[model samples]
Target: MALRRLSTLLALTFALGAVAGAVGARTAPRMWADQLVNVTTDDLRWAKTRVRVNVDHWDPGAQTGLHRHPGPTVIYVLDGEVEEVFPDGKTVRLRAGQGVWNPARTSHNVRNVTSEPARVLAVHLDPG
Candidate 1:
């Protein structure tokens, strides 16, 4: 009877571990970006600066952990939806065709709270 009880406990532990792992995985979905263009600004005002454009993809439930950029950035949603959370507790939900501008050194987090994947076009202007 003791041996049977031990086996049952082991099985229960294994089942709990599997459940925890699955839950952990769901909380941090993978995200990626595709660089579409990178060039140097030639205009007089922003001369010598780097202009980069990328297409960022976020899986359902994915989030860009609190972060900041060295340069000014712009994000335009191409598909799906995303929530931009600021350090001061502000939250903004953006949908397709919407956009937002983030100044340099701004701290924020972008999350895909929806069940569908999201695509965003990002433009960055970095000082050279």
Candidate 2:
């Protein structure tokens, strides 16, 4: 039964290792929803001035009400088509795999003008 005991120990070790890895990955420095709404920021290497992470989702016909950024921001299209509306009412269409970079303090809005829903990974610079 020593072999059985060793097998059990190995299994336990593997399980512990998996749990540790998962916890480490979750706690690792990454974006969370709190940063966007509350403006709670942590280490922002991307936004050397001020880093903010805002993962946005949009339904068909949905739009991101008027907003502005302090620094150039990145909008990575996740799916479907989106129109980035500028203050002048001009719009830039971004399809899947496309991206848009807005300069500091650029006013704009995001809308899913298509029938399909879309998602975007918006990374706005805090410029701290």
Candidate 3:
């Protein structure tokens, strides 16, 4: 009986630990990108253009530090909300289903100011 009780107690403890770890991971401030498509083509006038599509995940209060792309890019919010901050001090808030276009070499940063996590689909037309 004592051995059985110990085994049960160990299982409960492990279950609780797993739940806690999951919650912690969900709330951690972080960002990740999942690339969906990447294609390079020479058919366009510019020639050798790379088209890339990615799904980006942002945790609550997560931010992408100032950055720039080599070519034009578009970001569409898929869930939650995000704010885009430009180098010239301009800021734009985008919600689910909304999107923005950034010209080549435009420097900016993105942040999730809300309490909930956010996700966005990013499409890029980069010069190859």
Steric clashes per prediction? 0, 5, 0
Candidate 3 — what's its lDDT?
0.67
lDDT of each: 0.66, 0.60, 0.67
**Candidate 2 residue-wise lDDT, 1-128, digit = tens:** 64575356435533443343334232111232321222123443432445455445566777757888777777777567889998887989999768877878889987778987665656655666
TM-score of 2: 0.62
Q: List, residue by residue over 1-128, the lDDT tens digit for candidate 3.
A: 64575356435533443343334343333533331222222223334556555556687777878999998887877678999999889999999868888999999998889988876667666787
What does candidate 1's lDDT look like per residue over 5-112, in tens digits? Answer: 535643553344334333423222364433122212222232444555555667887787899888877777767899999999999999987888898988999988
Better of 1 and 2 by lDDT: 1
Cα RMSD for candidates in order:
21.6, 15.2, 17.9
Choose 1 or 3, whichever is better by TM-score: 3
Checking candidate 1 for backbone clashes, the offending pairs are none
Off by over 4 Å in 1: 1-46
Off by over 4 Å in 3: 1-46
What TM-score would every model get versus the actual structure?
A: 0.66, 0.62, 0.67
By lDDT, the better pick of 2 and 3 is: 3
In terms of lDDT, model 2 sits at 0.60
